[model samples]
Target: MKGTQSLERALDILFALGDDGETQTIAEIAQRISIPESSVYRLIQTLERNGLVERKGQGQIGLGLRILELAKSLNSQFRNRLKSSAAPLMEQLSEETKETVVLFVRTGTNVICVKSVAGQHLVRFVVEDGKTFPIQNGASGKAILAFETSKIINQVIHTIETDLVDDFLEELQVIREKGFSETSSEVDPGIIGIAAPIFDQANHVIASVTVAGPGDRIKDEKLSAIVPHVIKTAKRISSSLSFSTTLS
Candidate 1:
């Protein structure tokens, strides 16, 4: 195989392992990828030496701690960038709307809260850092679903066990057309949130910024008023990430 092909296969193996989230035998991996068991074993050995995969039991292998280390390092770097570039914008949004502002990034089929700032209100909602939520239940998730490729969006729809796929796509289309998404008492009763997508350097929606509060505090008029501010803050974060103005 060519060098690039080999590297791609290695990454594919890593992704497969992550998807399974458990140790698998060489034969199982080989069968999954339609590759020969001998080749799979050789690749597994190489990956083991590099600390990318580890043997868990007889003929079973899984991802190693090095991958976790790398993930942690990347997360730290992203958090630092967010603090330096997006934190001020989020703080400004919170102050302007007197609501909780949150930053979310896609993690597999879920969105993880990376940063948040609560408003001055005594009954404000709080989403702790590192907390994760389903991709079909919240404004931040809908913001991502609206902008991601159709392939990814379809995969999410296929995995859902409910009959709300049509409704979800209908709402996503509206959000895409309007440049933001909103949910009122969808994920949490009496709570509402508004979110706008944040683009990456390649103009892909890589994350989102959301402003949320209790429904009583975030009435229809207030939510409509803060939509522009939330969209503006998302644009600022996207700009800092080197996304083109066309995507904003």
Candidate 2:
């Protein structure tokens, strides 16, 4: 329809402006997109009215704060869903293991802790919520990196300013074979953590679940004991996200 075409053009114009990260005059946009200057002006005015775009100075235009507001609203909805589904599982895991349980997502080259539940034990290593960790240093980060595609893995590695690429790759291979990753005092001194990847419906590693505690308390025997439980909990969380596991 003519109306739909007009709306699409207007959206394209706004997207172009967003990509440039700078204000553009009507004549400049019209020249770039090969559209009439009059049409460009009309579209800009319409977008401005809806707070999607705003005039910066003179004839220049840029995105408005309304888009950020919309993004925050969407992020809040995601946070609510994560809490409802993952929080209970985190609590259950913490109770069962008597260690701190955390949920993290890989953002760029860092893994961010989004949710955490403290164990019943009085003494435990505490990781703050919203903490960002490097991909090569922690159990949770390694678990996520091991399951991610080779391209993504390499991209993350490229961001690291270290000569440990070969070492990291070897560790990742081991993690892939073992179906989980573990580290002792790698990220935090005197602490040990084990992590398993949480996958989505398409088998994409979207996040990881980890259990961390004092090194002495998380010895090899205890880690071996907790492996099955951690894997099961990770699978349960994945299932709640509509992900099917291949684990028998």
Candidate 3:
């Protein structure tokens, strides 16, 4: 019983630290968890020794390199699963649209391309795998942002220009309602792209599937033809991922 209590207390402290992604002093952690400062200090010492927590400047503590190591391993495995499941569908979308197809997942405030299938045409816009861009622009970003929680949405908006925040939020709403997002020159000049969100078993937006091409070849008619295919491809990836999650 005593061991269990200590474990719970340690978890409480960890949870508190995760809330705002900020360093916290021992006193602050103890107060937040309603524990004695001395006990908190002992618990922190054990955590520090195990590489779960580390001291920041000015007597503050933050998550340690061990946590990042674990996160990296988990993220790599999860991204591999996502890429494998998304590849066939993305390839089909690329062939059908004759444009670049990319799979993007959010990391912090940025969206990264985990997989990209190049377009067939010589004039196609090329997006390489592992490319990262801010979530404040592009159809791929908007597709994922539209389904994010309100807190995350507001947090991302706070990083944008004050004058553009409202417009960006409104655009998210429109994207949510429309089931997908499309843009021209939003991230790259002379490029057009369309994207739809992929969801997990719990219905959280885990990623986005995007189709992009050179603007000259992707005029209104081309854009209209490809949007449904993008939406469909995203749906297939989401469905497959959700089903796989349930099996796991």
* Superior by lDDT: candidate 1 or candidate 3: 3
Candidate 3: tens digits of C-alpha lDDT, residues 127-210: 888889998789999899999988789879889989998888888999999999998998999999899999987889999999
Q: Candidate 1, TM-score vs. the true structure?
A: 0.73
Model 3: residue 102 alpha-carbon error in angstroms: 0.8
Which should have the higher TM-score, number 2 or number 3? 3
Q: What is the lDDT, from 0 to 100, of the residue 3 in candidate 1?
A: 84
Q: Give the TM-scores of the predictions, in the order they appear.
A: 0.73, 0.70, 0.87
Estimate, for each residue in 141-194, the C-alpha lDDT of model 1 and write its tens digit. 989879998867887998876688888788889999999999988778998999
Candidate 2 at 227: error in angstroms?
1.0
lDDT of each: 0.87, 0.84, 0.91
Native-to-model Cα distance after best TM-score fit, residue 118 in candidate 3, in Å: 1.3
Per-residue lDDT, model 3, residue 154, is: 84
User: Which residue pairs show collisions in model 1?
Assistant: none
lDDT of 2 by residue, 1-248 (tens): 28998898887887788765788888988887778999988888888898988889998888888876886797677556655568888888888899999998877778989889987678897888899988878899999999988777888888766787788888999998988899988899999889999887787898889999998888978889988888888888888876322331
When 1 and 2 are scored with TM-score, the better candidate is 1
lDDT score, residue 237, model 2? 88
Order of all candidates by lDDT, from best down to worst? 3, 1, 2
